[model samples]
Target: MSSKRERRWWTEEEDQILKAGVESQSKQIGEVNSLMSWNEIAAMLPRRTNKDCRKRWYKVRSDFIKGTWSREEDRKLQQAVQQHGLKWALVSRDVESRNADQCAKRWQHGLRPDLKHTPWQPEEDAKLLQAMDKHGNKWKKIATLDLPNRSSHDIRNRQVLKQLF
Candidate 1:
């Protein structure tokens, strides 16, 4: 026998409660950490687990920036990459309003100087098809092993483009 919790989106009231709880604790301690803070916070929301509270706090936090990247941000990302060489946490500090994961993705997908942006040739498309057939949907493997100049994002998009036409 097994038990499963109901699945649903976090409500606005729940988000407010989570935000207030996290902010209150952060103010008290200068930073919120340890399982104790989360456990205490979770106690307030009977339905939520400690892990759920922590994850939702990250999503609702004011510093969680999103949306299109600016040219200035791109320039900062380039400089950060040069200075830190893939230490993404350090790189992220130089680019305002972006996280380490965002910084790494921006560099890998768009900023890397060596990334080939030219139109795909017919031969390359043929090669992409063969790689897909051989490897299924493993875009990273296809990008790395078969199309070194392309990112996994590009390889995945190409397959989508193929499907449309």
Candidate 2:
């Protein structure tokens, strides 16, 4: 027997069912998300299999799951990653929502700020060299010297460029 069901888009009504299923299934704080069984939640949404119900439930729950991305969400994700590095758990916490996976995926694409690509002006290069001399190649500290639109990474890359050339 074949094992594939034709994929179709979910309706708003189905979304409502998924929300209700999540509500009925889960109760209280930090109970490990057993809420309702997959089978039970699937039964609540017509034509949705257990896997579908489970995946959809994630979309419905904002925590440890996600529904949609927003600009504000992208900003939060960027800020969190900046503050916490690739520590996804800590980043997600700072973002105030989303599972670690969602946070990771969003960060990999959205709000991954574009690196400076234009040729550095001579003045900027001089300032960078001066900053390096003052700060002793400490890129993070040099960046704090107010190189507009330049991150510590940019400061580091500028030094690398000098070595290469």
Candidate 3:
């Protein structure tokens, strides 16, 4: 086998450290002409070169916007979405720790009142069809008409599943 080690995925903790290092170095640049080189960051991590550390940071840069989601943040998101409608830009700024995309996803998938959390029942399925007939794929409107538990997300999901299988 070669002496070179195989590359592995960076962990969340590693990514956090990498981001902090970059940010810290940037902030310190004003006070000092010198800065923490990529060499310094690489030295902090085991078996990584300067290039490797730099490349890893860039690779996962988008992740800076998305991190852990707490129930409190979820509640804030729901309130923000409810107050502002689907304006992700507004909701994202109001709800800290989540950007626009994350806020939109959480609303679309889970927090929205239009999405029912439970599995579909036969009665619910029958109602769904009636609502669909009346509304014609306008899931948000259909949801408000009859289904108390069902959200537009649930309706859309059920509709697709019905059409497919």
Candidate 4:
């Protein structure tokens, strides 16, 4: 099998080219549709593939929109947590988009206030057992209903069958 070549980062010149092309195309099309396809944009640039162009486009858009997280934002996030036990999602919405896993990690890492400890209640155990009985191993869906706060990894670890044959 032939090995794929490594991708290079976009330089300032390429950024200029992409911006100019997008601007001109948008004006011509009377909208941004013509400029939205990264593959078409890549075809106009030198030595870049559709994937590379798309990745760079997303990065540029994110940096331009968010302007990177600042020290002041970090300070505010910390203060919000200390003063009112604010959720990371609420505090960091302006600084960064917090997905489910990121929010969990932020809480675990002490970036947010510690979540109240909630042990698996008896009813939760019964529901999990019943779901497992019906589904035979659809831990993800079962976890969603029975342990909404738990991660898939956590649910997997807690599975009795996971420890058995």
Q: Which stretches of candidate 2 lie over 4 Å from their true place?
A: 1-117
Q: Taking the tens digit of each residue's C-alpha lDDT, what string does model 4 give over 34-151?
A: 1356677788997987667655654565432342435565565566556545454344343344322233344443343322245666776676677778776776676566556565
Q: Which stretches of model 4 miss by more than 4 angstroms?
A: 1-5, 33-35, 62-165
Per-candidate alpha-carbon RMSD to the true structure: 5.0, 13.1, 11.8, 10.2
Clashing pairs in 2: 25-35, 25-36
Local accuracy of candidate 1 as per-residue lDDT tens digits, 9-116? 998888888888888897888764432388888988878998788767756657857879989899999998999899876787677567667788888888888888
Give per-residue CA lDDT, model 3, range 38-131, as digits (tens). Answer: 8887877777787777667645656434557888899889889878989876787678666566788787767777556887899999998998
Model 1: lowest-lDDT 10 consecutive positions: 29-38
Query: Which of 1 and 3 is ahead in lDDT?
Result: 1
TM-score of each: 0.68, 0.37, 0.45, 0.35
Better of 1 and 4 by lDDT: 1
Candidate 3's TM-score: 0.45
Measured by lDDT, the strongest candidate is 1
* Residue 17 lDDT in candidate 3: 76
Q: Is candidate 3 or candidate 4 better by lDDT?
A: 3
Give the least accurate 10-residue stretch of model 3, judged by summed lDDT: 28-37
